[model samples]
Target: MNNYPFGSQAPKSFPAYPKTEFDLESGTAIKRTRKPKNSPFHPLRMIKSFGNRFHHFFKLHPLMGLFLALCFVLALAMILSLYGTQYGVQSGGYVKSDMGFDDYPFSKLQNLVMVAGHSIYTSSSCGKIEKEDSWFLESYQKNPGQAATFVTHIHEGIEIVARDDSALLLFSGGETRRDAGPRSEAQSYWAVADSKGWFGKEESVKWRALTEEHARDSFENLLFSVCRFRELTGTYPQNITFVMENRVGALEKLASDQGEKLTDVM
Candidate 1:
């Protein structure tokens, strides 16, 4: 018994490690730990990965992406072009009248009756102007009625013309509304006058009644009508009568500044 080298005591045994499992048929080791759960930024990571993948896709399909981009640009350009044309028409784009300055019959007219337009009439027939709805109702609330005031303006204009047979009557306005299309306020007033037969002086006033369809405001109404009178008659009016509800002081100042004579028609 004492023949052993370490004969005094028996050797202590060490603890045994657990055996790693493996597939017996394939001889592959099994996974011991599960993959860590994705972090809160997993979606961002996935988007980055997708972007890289798409980058590769674009590299492989460059022609398709370029075509799609070109198509988008063209569609945007078309939309802008259409919008620009529509806006141009609504904002008083160039329009030629059937009657030119050479066609004006009264070349020696020196007096002018300028009526400023306030609203666009909806009706096509001038006879129905009284029944037509105007663009703005608030501006006409202080008057008897929109249509009544409009008729009164026409009457006043024609009365001035009837009083003096040498005066040229001009209605001034521009296309001011998008929904109203390209119809000018000046045209509306002239149509109403025509429908009313120049308020009983059709014989004397019809030939002299004209329109300045490019004026956008009160100042333009005064200034443009003068210019139009010159263009038609080849001379500036010796006396000017402005028919409008407001802006009399401004018109007077404008006339004074421009060294033009304006007669207040009460």
Candidate 2:
């Protein structure tokens, strides 16, 4: 018999049974699980676990740690750039200025013997252009151009010099190459002009061509060519012309010497 109200919610009661455990296919009681003392639910334990992971990462790759440190420093630099100290016109900048046209004594010369120094060949032009043909490199390396870019200026110089009656066209370069034999750069230009037909008045222009050997540089080319010009004409050049990319300064230096006169043309 139950001791509970019939019409109300009744209190639960355990069924009468033996004190010994019953077997469901020889079953037994199992222990229940408890919460870990250092679980993620504990804030300090979670912090410690994260710190350990970071430490393990650094220990695995020292280089990776260094890379992270460098990134941090670079980020700092980028942030600092906002202060205008990193970039501005007045803050560590570069600008270029041009050398404008100014009159030079060589600017008025008639017997213009344009001596373009080794800057055109044996140096700038030769080393830069690798085209193994008539380029300054191949020509100077194998056989020197009758005049090289020097001839280009020489032709220009001759045009100016031809304005007068007495003008000599001279090109100078030594046997810089072993295979080219004993021919100087001057002789090569003479041959090319003679062979190529010197533009109508071939014989007349060919008579004006001269050669100067032993000039290894621009100064030597100018000075030696001047001496050769004086020797040929039996008088110093009344008006010496220098045709160059930029000839004023160089011509100034040469013309300022004792008994030398020159005029510069761009």
Candidate 3:
């Protein structure tokens, strides 16, 4: 999937931008003059007022959806035709690792450190990263220092991992905001850390860091990161620490709920 944000410039994770209205607005299409929103003949208000009727456009356009489904089926068929499905998943649950599941090097780590992400960095401009305008913020997140706090968490997670040889640090957050394009909060944090060279602890922390990108809420951040940690390490962490600045009570509650003692509260 194309998980990078819009624009020609993006993180190295994805090489090419995908199709979208943003592309049209970015001059990929022929430039054309359009009426301003404040114009008297603006039609969006009326269309939006239709509510469910407006949404019926999808129901009204079934052919396109059918074509998409057909394309997906064809793509799956093509892959199956080529690969032959010899390694297809079986119905039974996972077998014992014999000794241990060590395919991923993270299997050696025994502790987990998660940094819950709050926002994504949306700026293609290098200068605007520290600015509030560069993020897709909710009403509560419009404050000036909010963006900086997120950076602090990223740095703090790296520092924690650097200090603990057994710890595997995870940047935990999902693609929660549609307005922020396709970037996940976890990916955004990791990218920022990469851009900053892991805040001068690159060699010590880079290998320990990973991302849990499917979590969308506070509890999910902890739960999903634990599942990811177990997947990587083949065993649940003995201790889990969170690095969200000024937030400890929630993490403590979640840790207790997950049946782990919070040894160090920060």
Candidate 4:
């Protein structure tokens, strides 16, 4: 009774699905969800709600609203000022230091030990400066073994700085020798110290060792170095020390002029 034979082709009938019926979820969900009160998705609504509350408060007590706004502004200003102070450019130099203690070693080190330089090293030769002819000596300092004393002073200063972790060593003098072609005594001492390898404390004390090159006399050595210390460290020293006698009572008089006391090394 079939139109086609069993071994031949055959066709069957079925209901075709509509496109909307196939896409049922998009057309209509099983359960609809209502947005919660104070929904985060509605920012403009939240701002409008805040404005309404503020308006109500302002209408009730205008003085209170003014006071509250003033307080908020003050607090915001305080916060900005604090951040600005913490993050602003300091000193405004071409080479400005960061607002951290790590880069400022001299500030952390509180004590100063000054070595008064006596002569300029006038050597055209290199390195063996423990002898007499290497220095630009005065007539009085023309004797043998006199140049070695300068090296000794540098060594002693380095040793002291090495022993005290909080001390900075300074070689202080100026270019008093006009005939020596602008070489300063402070520079000479530093060069000698460098040649000596900072007396074996190169790693520990060499970096702390520096020179004050504008001191033309023993008094200037003290005065200029103190100013130099303040310039570099941003604070005055708690104490100062150097090895020299009151040869002409100038140091004693300088101390008296400032209303301070000096303990005589003699």
Candidate 5:
């Protein structure tokens, strides 16, 4: 009988199995060389690789990518809207109080034309005064003809200022009504004047026209506008011509107390 090892003789015709080499000096088996298995969950490298793959997919299918991007944006906008209601946000023209009043350029102007706001007017879609409501129904019924008076006052103030280049026209009133939503009577009058194009004197008077949006009554209208005049021009107005609907004796007393002259022109 052959004396060779039985298992070793059976493998001569078959492929020879590769043997692992060892370092004789260190006595450690050398590992077989292999290409690493691509792992999908590598912490540092997975994100970058996934981004690259996504970019490639988008490049291949652009229309689907655009639609997905738009959908994501819309979802984000909806989420923001849900948070927006928790905070109250109002929109309108903001009145700036800190206008560098000390550095006002029109300090030489000493003449003033001030118009008092009496009522808030909202003409109907038909453009008739009879269909409008002026803040309160009782007040509107008491003086249903005040719209023409308001327009006349606005035009007269504009004409006075247009005749004199050195005069500044000021509209004075406050947000007195709660239902008006912080809309000032002064701003309302200024809007009416603006809509009417300053009654054909826009070029001469528009630049000088401004609003004092914090006077509750006629005395405040006169007193606050005097302060506003000083703030705007850096000096008190030398000659104040008030264009108001009614004569206010308190205005005369205020002018006397301030050692200033007050003139009423209808």
Candidate 6:
């Protein structure tokens, strides 16, 4: 009966929460939502976060990574090669080879050989011909058996080698004049040279009168003398002194360029 007395009373009520909807019609359409945070250990996050770290991991660990690195290197090398081939290099620059010899050193040079040339002597065996036939003929005839030319040149070379005990003198030429025989022109002049002597040093002068008999032109003078120089010294001559008349600037320049190109082709 007591329970029935409260029939008109209502049951206990629960708390209600307000709705959180946006009102687009009222200009409040935007709403904020929290982003899902990335894990510090995830694969995508690791790749995006570290550049070199990911690259190094790929490089050292797997065959595919090593192959890719090698491919990249090869591509870079090819690009550089193409660039160098296009531009090449400038002219007249000194190129040093790994095993190149030093130039002839005049001061430290021992066993020095100076070859003073005369067109008459070089062409003597060919017999007399037109003035135009010999390159040095006109100059030789003008100077005419001056002996002073070779004498003066020899003196200079002697003075250069006087202090060094190892030096030797080399006289080079052939019998080019019609009056001359096949006998070496170097020997003929050197005999006259032996009698006159070198100022007070005739002993020094007589001891070093070696000869080379095959030079026909200035080019031959240099080339043949160099061969002779090499043969006597066991090694090539350390220094070669030349005494001649006129413009030799072109001679050496052409010889060096053509020689290098020809050598490369071979």
- The TM-score ranking, best first, is 3, 4, 5, 1, 2, 6
The digit string of per-residue lDDT tens for model 3 on 131-243 reads 78888889999998888777777877888888999999999999999988889999888988998888899998898899999998777888899899988888999988887
Using TM-score as the measure, the top candidate is: 3
Per-residue lDDT tens digits for candidate 4, residues 123-221, read 876476877888888899898888777777777788778888987788889999999988898888888888788889999998888889999888898
lDDT of 1 by residue, 146-217 (tens): 677777887898899888978999999998665788888898888888878777899988888999999888
Query: On residues 1-266, what C-alpha lDDT tens digit does candidate 2 reach at each position?
Result: 87777565877666455355545575653445676787347888889998798688889988997798799999998887754453444236732222222332232233646544332223222323222353234433454443345446545655654556556667665555555556565555444444445545455555666677767655666777777665555456666665554535554776777556676655
The TM-score of candidate 3 is: 0.60
RMSD in angstroms, candidate 1? 15.7
| 1 or 4, greater by lDDT | 1
TM-score of every candidate relative to the true structure = 0.57, 0.44, 0.60, 0.58, 0.57, 0.43
Candidate 3, residue 43: Cα displacement in angstroms equals 57
lDDT of 5 by residue, 1-266 (tens): 75667885654664344367767799677897988998576766878887898799899999998898899999999998866655534355334344455568676678989999876654423244333354322354366565677778888999999988899999988887666666787887788888778889999889889989889899999989988998789788989999996758889888888888778978
Badly placed stretches (over 4 Å) of model 6 are 1-109, 119-140, 143-147, 254-266
Better structure of 3 and 6 per lDDT = 3
Count of residue pairs whose backbone atoms collide, per candidate:
0, 7, 0, 0, 0, 6
* Candidate 3 residue-wise lDDT at 97: 42
Return the candidate ranking by lDDT, descending: 3, 1, 5, 4, 2, 6
Which ranges of candidate 4 are over 4 A from the true structure?
Answer: 1-105, 245-248, 256-266
Indicate the residue-level lDDT of 147 in model 4. Answer: 77
> Which residue pairs in candidate 2 have backbone atoms (N, alpha carbon, C) closer than 3 angstroms, thus clashing?
105-263, 106-262, 106-263, 106-264, 107-263, 107-264, 146-189
Pairs of residues at least 3 apart in sequence or in different chains that clash in candidate 1: none
For model 1, give the 10-residue run with minimal summed lDDT. 131-140
Model 5: CA > 4 A from native: 1-102, 123-141
